[model samples]
Target: MRHRRIGRSGLLVSEISYGNRFAHRESANCARAALEAGITTFHTAAAWGHGAAEEALAEGLREARRDDIVLCTGVFWLEHPGASQFGLGRKHLMSSLHGSLRRLGTDHVDVFQLWRFDHRTPLEETFLALSDVVREGKVRYVGTAEWTAEQLLRADALANELRVPLLCNHAHYSMLWRAPESQVMPAAARAGIGHFASMPLAQGILTGKYRQQRIPPGSRADNDERGRSAVRPFLDASLLERVDLLRGIAEEAGLTMAQLAIAWALHHEGVASAVVGASRPAQVAENARASGVELGIDVLTQIDQLLGGFVQSDPRLTFTPTQYDDL
Candidate 1:
């Protein structure tokens, strides 16, 4: 696997990073496969299966040396009763980090990210708290997930002032979702913050499995309510039709639809890593192979011609507004 540095940071992550958002039953096995395939970066969150994902990762990497793995987790979305239990507040962040560390069986995660921007809280307060974690040696680098370009710029400035420089920004970027290219990608490039592309497969849409309105058995949409809701928007006939066209191009290039999608996401210079979710070990192996696969310019143009109009470039799609109000 090819390794890329996150901006100017010392951290070098695998081009294809393993993420455990769904937290499948074979999570440990899949993670092991990722490691065997040279994927050292593993991403999880406090809200992912309510810490079960971290536990599985800990078990999967139990035999590997701690320094060899780049474990990443997020705060701002823990299971708690009160409103104060979420967001980037000092109390909540401290508590959330402690819980994550305990679950992962590690003294420090390579990167600790805020799951979402806490609009209700001042940026100063958030950065101060994150800087404290870095100083205390609890987290090596600070980052954000689903934060907009503007929000990332503000946070990066604050983090610099606090001496903790925000090193990464996790956002949705896939063959079907090109939203980050418009603003987030440029902003991260200018700020020297590495962009980690989440949902590189568009939640399995680019995998060519959900075609002709047929949701395959045991698929994410069939098994998880939230997964179904998340992918429902892209189920229109027009989008699927475009995917069919892209599939033809993938076959012409001697690649699977999923491989084509992953290679496309990594083609951008601004994207340092593509965070992919997998339920099985085989899926992990397949995705890892796409890391260094460079598509020809003609093939890229064909992909864009087929999918340009279908791309979801809305900046607001980065994070849900209701999440803040619900908290």
Candidate 2:
């Protein structure tokens, strides 16, 4: 697998990383397959399966060398209702990291990310806590996910002030969602922070299995209420019809629709990695192969023309739980 450093930091990750958020009862199998496929980075969060995901990932990586893999996890939106259990406050961050380290059977994690921007907590406190974790040897590099472009720039500035290298912004960017391209990527580019495009597959919609427009049994569209809701907004008649057209482009490129989608996200210059969550081992391997596939300029442009009006590009139009009213 091809690997790249996160932003200006020395922490390297595979072009195709594995995340266990939606991995199933066979998560161990998927994780093992990732390691076998040379996937060094694995992502989990305190909110996934209430920590079952972390333990399952550790079980899968039990036989691999510790230093050979990068364990990247985040904290936010916990199951608990306590006031102190959900935000990026120092107390919650420390508690969450300690719990994650213990669950993963490690003393330190390679990258500790804030799953969301906690508007209630001061950014100053959040950055300070993140810096403290690096000093305490619990976290190597600090990052965030699903944050607005303005929040990311302010975060980069604070990290610079605190001298803590903010490694990357793990945002929702894909063939269907181009909001990050509007301002997030440019802001990160100016701040020297890398970008990890989460949800590159659009919750399996880009896999082309849905091209027939039939909801397959046991698939995410059938079983996942949240997943269904997540993709519901984007599955319009025009976009769905356009996906059928996209299949031809994928065929011409000698790639699957899923592969084409992932490669499309990676085609962006600032994207250090594209994080893919798979429910099965074969999905893991299939996504792993998308690492080195290159699309030519003509194919890329053709794809742009076909799916042009369907994508979400404006960051202002981007919806997230937290907004920068302070901006």
Candidate 3:
């Protein structure tokens, strides 16, 4: 696996990270498969499967006995309901970090990210709490996920002021979701913060399996309500035809449709990793090989032109209008 440094920090992660957000129940097996497939990084969350994901990941890593790998987890998703239960407040952050550590069966995680930007809490409070954990030997690096360009800048500055530089800004970047490129990716690149691309396959639509208006049995579009919702937006016949055309491109590039999608997401200097979920070992192996695959400028341009209108680019759509305005 090829390694990329997270932002300007010494922390390095495999270009392709195995994320267990969707397959938390099978994470132990998935983690083992990931390590075998040369994936050194694992992305999980505090509330994934209500903490089952972290524990399962720990089980797999323990069985593998590899502490030299990067383990990344996040805080948010309102793990519980309480006045002080959520957000980036010190109380929640400190307690959340301890809970994550205990569940992962480790003293610390390599990257402890603010999974959501908490407008309710001061950015200073968030960074201050993050800095304390770094000093307490609990978290090595701090990052953000799905934050806006403005929010990224504000938090990055606050983190620097606290002497705990932010490492990466992970966001939803895929064949269909290009909104981050409007401002988020450039901002992170300029700030020397790495960008982690989540959902690089556009929730499986770019994999070509959803082509010809046929949703395969047991696919995300079939089983998961949330997954179905994510995949529903691209179900138009014209868009499905455009997605099907990617099969020829993938063949010409000597890549699978999924691999082509992943490579495209990683085809930037600022993007450090593509976080993907897999259900089986074979799927993990296939996704791992796309880490270092390079695409030419011609291929990129063709892709951009093929899926023109279906792609999302508006920065305001990053979240709700009211929420984005507040950010």
Candidate 4:
């Protein structure tokens, strides 16, 4: 697997990091497979399965060398204390990190991210809490996910003010969703922050498996709440037609729809890593192979035509909850 540094830091990660949100049941095997596949980076979120995801990942890493796997997780919610497994407040961030470390059976994590942009709290307050964690050695790096370009810039400014290093932003950017091309990607590039594209598969929509009309049994689309909600807005004829066209392009490229979809995400220069979640080991290997496939200019141009080329942010054009506020 190809590896790259996160942001401008010396910390290196695989091009395709293993996403642990849905790998809970078989996390041990998943981690073993990832190591066999040369994927050393693994990421999870506190809100995913309400901490079961991280716990599973911890269990998986037990069999692997501690230095071989880089672990990360985010505080999922910043609302009421009950809303999140760990709120973003100083107290909550510390308490949550300790609990996460204990669960993972580690003293420190490679990266700890804020799962969402908390509009309710001052950005400084949150950044400060993260800075404290870094100083105390509980978290090696700090990052954010699903935040706007403006919010990311402000975060960097705050990090600078506090002398804390802000590493990256985790967002969803795929052929079906390219909102980051306009603001998020450019902002991260300018601020010297890495951009990790989460959910490059669009909850299996880009895999062409769903074109069969029904979600396959045991697939993320069939089992996860977010997966189900994400596909709801795209039930219209226009979007479905677009999806079909994109699938045709993938066929011409001699690639599975999954390969084309993942390659489409890696094609973006701003993306430092693409975290791929798989339910099975074979699925993980398939995604890892796409790291060798790169789309040339001609294929990318054809793809642009199918994807409407430009970033479209009409709230009316959302495909899922993750795509809802994309702009």
Candidate 5:
């Protein structure tokens, strides 16, 4: 697998990393397969499978050296009782990290990210808490997930003021979802922060399984109701046409649709790593194969035209405003 430096850090990670949601036993096998395929990075979230996924990954790491795999996890959806589970309140973040440590079977994570930007918590409080983790050696670096460019800039400036390392930001980016270019990618590049792209396949929409008038059996659309709902607004007739055009490009390149999608993300200069979530070992292998193939500028331009002018019009795009009353 090809390796790239994560932000300005000397640490180099594989272009494609493994991600797990809940498949404990299955994820263990997947990790092994990923290691065999030369994928050295693994990402999981505390909220993933409600923490069961981290437990399984920790169990899998028992067979490998700690340094052999670069482990990362985020704190989101932890039980916060009175406070919102999504933010970075001190009580909530401390409780959540302890729980994540217990589940991951590690005291420190390579990169500890907040699952989302906590608009509620005072930036100072959140930054201090993150700095404390690094100071105490419980986390090597800090990051945020699903945050906008403004939030990232504010956090980086805070990190600079506090003399702490703010390493990266994690968000979803793929051929189908190119929204990061407008702000997130540029902000990260300017601030020397890594941008790890999640869901490189657009929740399997770009996998070339769905066709005109036929949704493939066992696809995310068939099996994941929430995923289908999330894509409904974007899946209008025009987008379907775009998907078909994208399919032709993939076919011409002699690669699978998933491979082309992942390659698109990895081809970017600003992307530190593309996190791939797989249900099976074969899926992990297929994703790892993408690191080797690079899409040329001509291919990217064609894809841009085919998929341009699309917006995330799904209802889920506008989430309930974050709770800041407690702060």
Candidate 6:
């Protein structure tokens, strides 16, 4: 697998990072397969499967050298009883990091990210807390996910003030969703912040597995309520027809539809890594092969033409408002 440095930081991550957003049950096996396939970066969030995903990954990485893997996790959301229990407060951030470390059986995560933009808290307070974690040697680098262009700029400025590097931004980017390309990508490029393409497959819609209206048995659409909701928005017949056209291109290129979709995401200059989640070991192997597959300009143009009008590039699609205004 190809590795790229995140932003201007000294750390380098695999171009195709393994994630455990929906692969809770088989996370261990999937992670192992990814490692075997040369995927050095693994991403998980504290809220993913209520922290079970991290535990599974820890178990999976038991046989590998700790220094060989780049582990990433996030804070700002927890499975607590009350609403105030979450956010970017110092208490919550520290507690979340400690909990994640214990579960992952690691002293420090390679990267710790803010799962969401906590508008309820001051940016200074949040950055200060993140800076403290880095100083304490609990986190190597800090990052954010689902943050808008403006939010990223503000955070980067604060990181400069605090002498902390806000190294990466994880945002939804895929063949179907190009929202980040317009604003976040340019902003991050100018700020020297690498972009991690989360949900690079549009929750498997771009994988060509769900061709018709019916949800496949034992698939994420059938098992995960949130996954179903996320995939529901792109379930139009016209979209499916376009997917069929893309499949032909994949075949001609000697690639699976999923690999073509992943290669498409990695084609962008600003994207450092494409974070992909898989439920099976074979799927991990398939995604690993797309790491260095650079599409020719002709094929890239054809993909854009086929996906015309189907690309969802609206910035508002990734906007997340503050949950608590009073805080």
Candidate No. with top lDDT: 6
Report the candidate with higher lDDT, 1 versus 5: 1
Clashes of each: 0, 0, 0, 1, 0, 0
Model 6 TM-score on a 0 to 1 scale: 0.96
Q: How close to the true structure is residue 271 of candidate 3, measured as C-alpha lDDT? A: 86
lDDT of 1 by residue, 1-327 (tens): 999999778889999999987566899998899999999999999777777888998888888889998999998775545444778888888888999999999899999988888877888988888888899999999888888889889888887789995789888889888877888888988889997889999989999898997888888898978879988988988889889888788888888888899889999998889999888899999999888889999999998788878877887677634455644
Inter-residue clash pairs, candidate 6: none
Clashing pairs in 2: none
Residue pairs that clash (backbone atoms under 3 angstroms), model 5: none
lDDT (10s digit) by residue, model 6, range 4-100: 8888888899999999874367889999999999999999977677788888988889998999999999987764445457888888888889989
Angstrom error of the Cα, residue 107, model 2: value is 0.7
List lDDT for all candidates, in order: 0.86, 0.84, 0.84, 0.76, 0.78, 0.87
TM-score-better candidate, 1 vs 3: 1
**TM-scores for every predicted model:** 0.96, 0.94, 0.94, 0.89, 0.90, 0.96
Candidate 3 lDDT score relative to the true structure: 0.84
Q: Which runs in model 2 stand beyond 4 Å of their true positions? A: 81-84, 323-327
lDDT of 4 by residue, 151-210 (tens): 889998998898787888888877767767777777888888997888788777778666
**TM value for model 5:** 0.90
- How many steric clashes does model 3 contain? 0
Deviating ranges (above 4 Å) for candidate 1: 80-84, 320-327
**Which residue window of length 10 is worst by lDDT in model 3?**
318-327
